[model samples]
Target: MRRGRDEQGQVSLLIIGFAGVIAMVIAVVVDASAAYLQRSGLDTLADGAALHGADLGATGEDVYTGGLPEERLALTEPAVRAAVGDYLRRVGAHRSYPGLTFTVAVDGAESVTVRISAPLDLPLRFPGSPADTTVSATGSAVSTVD
Candidate 1:
């Protein structure tokens, strides 16, 4: 009888601890899912921007006069930067994602790369996790005469 009385509330304590652990796990899952979704969206945006840049920047007026190249198209940094900026504004990227930042680079005179970053607010946060984080994505496109 004495032992039973002493252990009366032990199960309740165990249940409470389990409940806490469950809540933390749920929080972690929710935050991680949110981050993954954000990254996916950014990936799409970056791909579009890179493709647009490659299409417009890889061509020069000489292409019209001289005809399409026998090899890979030549990519220019200035032209790619301008084209990327234009695409972002045309697609309303800034309006879609707050605190979004991006960079465009001409790679090896044949391809263009776009890297984008955006701030994400996690739906839930655990004790060791952050409520806010930055998610990034990179996209590249190569121009071939074929």
Candidate 2:
């Protein structure tokens, strides 16, 4: 049997290619799962923060206690931001997610929205995977009087 130069290292090249592909797949899966899980956790946290911003924000306690001075309920921008910040600090969100950033928005007088973002570190450093990425989640809440 006669062997050509092309055939000599063909098997080795195929093995290396397959190995690279497998490593890339693993990296993608791990990083993707991490991002997804972080997003889910952030969603829950954002929901809680939104609720806190709406209920414990400026004039929030007064309204809940039936002590509002005005006929309508209103959520002030500064108040909502402060409330969300306090809530996150109390819950240790900053400690849990390093480099966490958040924003609070008031949708008129009835709704408060909380959006949180954080940098995600990849567990696996593959050829195409970024060393760091960002994940974010948003939550909103409305105040109602019965």
Best by lDDT: 1
Candidate 1 lDDT over residue span 1-146, tens digit each = 34534568889999999999999989888888988988999999999999999989877675677677788888788888999989999999889888999998887988999999999888877677865699999999998887
- TM-score on alpha carbons, each prediction: 0.88, 0.85
Model 1: runs farther than 4 Å from truth?
A: 1-5, 60-67
The C-alpha RMSD of each candidate to the native structure, in angstroms, is 2.0, 3.0
Model 1 whole-model lDDT (C-alpha atoms):
0.88
| Model 2 ranges with Cα > 4 A deviation | 1-6, 58-72
Instruction: Write model 2 residue lDDT over 120-139, tens digit each, in one string.
Output: 98788866566669999999
